[model samples]
Target: MGSSSRRNTMSDVTIIGLGPMGSTLARTLLKNGTNVTVWNRTREKAEQLIREGAEFNPEAAAAVSASPIVIVCVANYEASHNILGSHEVAKNLEGRLVVELSTGTPQDARNSETRVREQGADYLDGAILATPAQIGMPDTPIFLSGSEAAFRRSEPVLKILAGNLIYMGEAVGAASAWDLATLATTFGAMFGFFHGSRILESEGYRVDSFGSMMADISPVLGQMIKYEGEIIQTGAYENPQSSVKTCRGTADLWLKQALEAGINNEFPTFAMGLFNKAKAAGYENEELAAVMKVLR
Candidate 1:
């Protein structure tokens, strides 16, 4: 590690892969006084960092061996395996801490965890939730899951990389599972807003006002999330603040509105169907989150 805020040519960390995300990770560390050793198949992708005092390793194994703490953010699980699954790379990875901050499936993380552990490496799998520009920002987060030992060893450096560091659990796939679930939530909300905006635009209504309305939704959403968390953990969705049947009433109104507007009602229809499923199972009095049971 460099100074609390001083990075130089002698990097304390090695970063494998210089794709947009990887390169940004390296530069963010460099800017925050953490020297980085970088490697990429395309030598030129690391030119800027090389000038910023990052050691350019032409070989993947060499990059893996450069520092005790190595971070990988590559194209995919296959590419990750191709780069580090070789015997040549494995030889240098003994007792090393490898944090994979790449977009991959839960199974991908589990597979990589097994392979790296077999080679005597400490593995931590992660999913970055922010874009390249948000790498070192205060609110940017990345979900992490792996051995507790691996996570503890990487925490200091990781905190320098991201403002919010969420440690999911020892299950290597936990982080990816949460990442996908979060994405579903994100896209679901976005899709609803997109459809609403389009529907309004189609009828010469202003969509700009919806932005402020959505901001107001943020807190309501936080409360919903908190309520659901308790409900799920208890496994007793009984006596909800707002019962499934009650929400279904609003869901019905939404479906009718979408129909009247000639807008696609699929989203509302799908939600109503879920509510109906819970009601059919005689859970109409439980919290809306009770529908998760049917989901399983």
Candidate 2:
């Protein structure tokens, strides 16, 4: 801790990396009356925030020392390591809380925690589930996992950026794990939508209308996913409302349609391959979720 006068002048938090997301975080915190200290590799990037009443620290080590909580929103773990991995800067981490918002693997999170803790600092691995524009909103989500005590200490400040805080317990890697899993689910649907759009285009139908329809019936789609997850979790693949054979029929139809329309069939081909594996395993008559068995 610094002297009384120095502490009085210090910001509540120091934000590293002045990228769009980092700038948004600083702006949001300033908007909410939280004193903010900002730093970036490019000094020009900190100019706008300085005009908005943010204090600019030219050095990464000094910037981190200016606040009790430091939030690093850089490009990735590699960039983060390049900045804070230095012995000089890492030394300044003592008696502070470090929140890493950079995206990386679960192992990255674990390694980050080890490094920060080795410097006598508390660390929280965080994953922002919302976009820059979504920051500071009450419903905007952020997932965090780390030392429970550290999380408790940082919760109020973290909630200032994202009110919907999902604390995934003390496992530092949990936040990144959840982020990657959610990304997989989201991108998988996006790829499916790409193929679906092709299907609509092939039929001379409006793809935007199909998207609107998906939005309208998203709850029903969500329910189907939930049911399948339950089936997979419970290892229950019997008495299916929709069997593997029936689901495979839809994949066949997609492939047939794609062939007839002279369109790409990559998505359907992938699905057919999985379903075919299940069929080979004698699960054609089982629930659609039995595909997991083949996958496992």
Looking at model 2, report the run of 10 residues with the lowest lDDT sum. Answer: 1-10
Kindly report which residue stretches of model 2 are placed more than 4 angstroms away from their true locations once superposed.
1-8
lDDT of 1 by residue, 1-296 (tens): 31222333335789988888899899888888886888888888988887786788788887777788999889888888988988889899997899998788999999999999899999999999988988887788999999999999999999888989999989999999999999988899887788778667768888888878888789988788887988898897877888899999988987887877787888788888999999999989988888889888
* Model 1 CA lDDT for position 111: 95
Error of 1 at 39 (Å): 1.5
Segments in model 1 whose C-alpha atoms lie over 4 Å from true places = 1-10
For each candidate, give its TM-score against the true structure. 0.87, 0.95
TM-score, structure 1 vs. true? 0.87
The clash count of every prediction, one per candidate, is: 0, 0
Count of clashes in candidate 2: 0
The TM-score that candidate 2 achieves is: 0.95
Which is the leading candidate under lDDT? 2
lDDT of each: 0.86, 0.92
